[model samples]
Each structure stands twice: as structure tokens, then as C-alpha cells.
Target: MPNFKLVAPYCGVRKYDKRFFVYYLETEENIRREYIFNTDEDVSNFSHALENLTAFMNNVPVCKKEAYHQEFLDLLLREVDHKLNIRTDPSKPSAVALAIEA
Candidate 1:
């Protein structure tokens, strides 16, 4: 297996064949590094893991000596909402946004 490095905050999944798919991350240097996932379950797990990793990376302050977990989670959600162009209100999200999130 090729050693892959994740250097970006964004990722994408691409279908490679009937029985295989590629999970790739866009590096900060504009390079795309990919890994193969052979099963649907593997793909799903990869997606979830990547989402959680990025969420933590984006919210946790690297320079800070200490940070509250709850505060970081709240900030992360706010950042996600802003990026998705969703309203800050507690109202239900639109169908399109929901689809995108899913």
C-alpha cells in the first residue's frame, strides 16, 4: 500500500470501479493523495473518520495550552454552519442543506 498523507481540510470520494472506490484528501500544496476502499462499509467508516478528524483539527486551538472540549465543539458547529451557508437559528435546515450534510 502507498503511504498517503493528509495535508488539507477537504476531501472527496471517487468511484474507481464496480467493486472499489477511492477516498482522497486535497493537500495544502494542491496535491491529491488517495486510498482505496474495497467495501461499502469501509467507505462509510472512512467518511465518518475523516469528518471527525477535520472537525477536531478545525476547532482545537493548536497554540493554546488548554481548551474546553464543550466550547470547542460549539465553535466547531458554528464554523460548520457558516461554511454550509446555513442560518444560525435553531430552526430546521432546508432540504438541500440536509441532503448536502447527509
Candidate 2:
């Protein structure tokens, strides 16, 4: 497997809307991939996840395929419970509400 170098992981709010956030990972070959989030909490969580993944990549010898596969599994596991929680609890506080309280 070819080893690709990754750099410049960034996250920030979109200028047009404060509620929207964007994050991306850039590679040495200049390819960029981005994710847009509707909630600040999601963006924050993604940023933390990316940081942890980068750290793991740096310390581990795994290839990109393995790393990405692990991340995909993690996301799938998280989304299942997250979506279920939202659907099961109509009275749950939203990300916006949590942010305001904080």
C-alpha cells in the first residue's frame, strides 16, 4: 500500500452562518476533503476525533486503509446510538441548547 502524508487539519464556522461549521484534512499531494456540520457540538466532536486519529496515525504503523476502516467503524457505532437517542427522546436538549447553557 502506498503511504500518503496528511497535513493541515482545520475546523471553523462558516462566515455566512454561525451555526454551520466546516472541517477538512489536506494531504501532501494537495487533495482536500471536507465535512460540514450543522451543530457546533458535532463539529467540536469531529475536531477532537480528527486530532486523536492523527495522533494514532503518527504512532501506529497501520496503513491508510486500516486507519480509515477503523474510523468508519467508530463513526457507525456512534451514529447508531446517537440517532436512537434522538429518536427515543423528543424532550432531549439540542446541541444549540447545550451550547447556550455552556
Candidate 3:
């Protein structure tokens, strides 16, 4: 499974269930052209969707090295943190860290 960075801080959110959330990115070219999906789903499709939409957003036919910005970088970091259940608080150790300590 490949990882995908969130496109924006305010990437749209959907309620899959009370306990689940599906964050999506809206296409700027057209309001109706949104790429909506959930994290809990298959990662292969998720990665493909992200790559395709990102290329479109950058107005490039393929991925480029200088296409990303700070905001996008932050979004990618946050997405990984969220997936790994990493807490922002320094006082508390992450579950994985605690497990290693034990």
C-alpha cells in the first residue's frame, strides 16, 4: 500500500459512520469534479486517485519535484501522523513507543 498526503487542511470531510471519517479533496477546475474516498478503503486505488488529482492540480501531466509547497508538505506529514496514531503532545508517548518501553 502506498501513502497519500492530504491535499489541504480543509480537505472536505465525510461521515462514513459515527466513528469513521473520510477526508477528500475538491477539484478546483470544477465543483463537481471532486475526488472523494475514505482512508479505511484499499490503498492502491487511494494512491492512484491522489496521484491523478495532484497532477491535475499542478497543471502538469506528470509528477514534478518542485510541484509541492509547504502547505502540501504539512498535509502529508499530518496524514502519516494520523494513520500512525501519533499524538502532538510531548508528555505522552505514542502507543508504539510505549509498547517498545514495556
Residues 1-102 of candidate 3 have per-residue lDDT tens digits of 012234433232222221122232222221211223244443444445445555555563334422443244346445442232211334443332333235
Candidate achieving higher lDDT, 1 or 2: 2
Q: What shift in Å separates residue 31 of candidate 1 from its native position after superposition? A: 1.9
lDDT of 2 by residue, 1-102 (tens): 011223222212222221222222222222222334456666566555545655655554544644563465367346532221111123444332233345
Ranking by TM-score: 2, 1, 3
Quality of model 1 by C-alpha lDDT = 0.36
Model 2 residue 16 CA deviation (Å) reads 10
RMSD to the native, candidate 3? 13.5
Residue pairs in clash, model 1: none
The lDDT for every candidate, in the order shown, is 0.36, 0.37, 0.34
Report the candidate with higher TM-score, 1 versus 2: 2
Which stretches of model 3 miss by more than 4 angstroms?
1-4, 8-41, 60-102
The alpha-carbon lDDT assigned to residue 23 of candidate 2 equals: 20
Q: Score candidate 1 by TM-score against the native.
A: 0.34
